[model samples]
Target: MTRSMCRTRRAGKSAGVVAAALMALAACSSSSDSSSHRATGSAPELSGTVTVFAAASLKESFTALGREFQRQHPGTKVTFSFNGSDSLAAGINAGAPADVFAAASPKTMAVVTDKKSTAGTPATFVRNQLEIATVPGNPHKLSALKDLTASGLKVVLCDRTVPCGAAAEKALAAGKVRLTPVSYEQDVKGALAKVELKEADAALVYKTDVRSAHGKVEGVEFPESARAVNDYPIALLKNAPNAAAAKAFIALVRSAEGQKVLTGAGFLKP
Candidate 1:
């Protein structure tokens, strides 16, 4: 009887151990399945066209970046709508189908945020300072902010809605100089274009913009420019149909590769 009982007890112990092992194995299997499901469910594959609404000042650099992005992502076209920051913000607020927005100023970006048009918080990607872009050789001999007020110089400035115009206003306010422009251009490019086309003797534009213009014009540095530095902010649109692509593009813009290209085109990293 004792021997029979001992065998029975040992068998029972073995069964319990086996049962525990089976339970543990089942738990591990359940955990692994959940983990796999989560891993598979988290991130979707990214593709498609990314529509970017950018400030006019970003035209040159962003165009180059768009080309490079297309090279990296075959069949992925980047459609850009370049204009004044306010205009872009207004467009986004009006239900435009833009995937991303890159503005020349935080203040302008506020318009989007206020309207809840942004998918995420805006990130400052670059900083730009104003320079006096003038006709070749600066025939007016313009050198300072006050020089525009001199007799017989045709000056152009960005519209009050744009970042460059805001900077120009702040710079003028800081320097206590009043300048009446021949035209209040609708955008920064328009302001610079006036000088480039010889329609205006000079225009206030970002140094980066002037640099990108190459031989089209010459730039003059002024003291008050330091007081009004414009920060470039970029954000994904709230209604972005291609949110993943928009995020990827924003990452690329903030990445070292993007910075290299932007800096090369005269943008300063923020």
Candidate 2:
């Protein structure tokens, strides 16, 4: 090998090494940029109003969860319509504009699902039992389901169409106690209000409602309630305008943090 040839070969080897290094550096930079782009676009930004039609029984806990969801997602808003599950289901079936539906019972939930108004199968998230909501301090000393049967006890009850009313009837039947109510309110909250306002001596309501009352009424638990526990189911509406936010809200309700708020509000885990 001549000296000149040796020098040329050495120079060629140096160029090859430099070229490889440059290619490696370019590849690294390209990979970094691609990763940065993916990182920025990985999560789609969630923004919109999520309208929820929920049973009155879920008002307290769901409201808290809604606030938490909005906080976690700054650009999103949660609006809730709290009412009798039956009524809410009817509205949904009638093409009401709602993102989510949380019913007090599977029966009520089916009213929408059977109509094919829901996006998917409903999920039971919690259970609730009946309690006799009496005036603060239990002036009548109503201890059991039978006590509500006393003559002249101005007792109120939810109408038979609503979940609370249906549960109340189940509990009543379980106790084998026959009683006529002064009035059958359209919803549990209405029945509970009768007790809170001292209009009714006692009303068959949910344990959660009595607790949410914050001393406005007293709660009486009966063994019959165990047989009449109601299951709460939630689902996304097929016509949900804000599907993404609605799904997120449902996820939150089924999440540990959501369950914590619900359990803290006297609801039983599913």
- Winning candidate number (lDDT): 2
Clashes, model 1: 0
Q: State the lDDT of candidate 2 residue by residue for 1-270, as single tens digits.
A: 333332211122322432333333233334455456558996566789999999998887788778777766668999999999989988888778999999999998998888763657899999999998988888788898898878789999999999999999999999999998999998888998898888888999999898788788888989999999999999988889999899989998997556656766778999
Q: Could you tell me every candidate's TM-score relative to the true structure?
A: 0.82, 0.85
Per-residue lDDT of model 1, residues 151-205, tens digit only: 8889999988789999999999999999789889989888888988999899999
TM-score of 1: 0.82
11 in model 1: Cα distance from truth in Å?
82
Tell me the lDDT of candidate 2.
0.82
What is residue 13's positional error in candidate 1, in angstroms? Answer: 82
Stretches off by above 4 angstroms in model 2 are 1-39
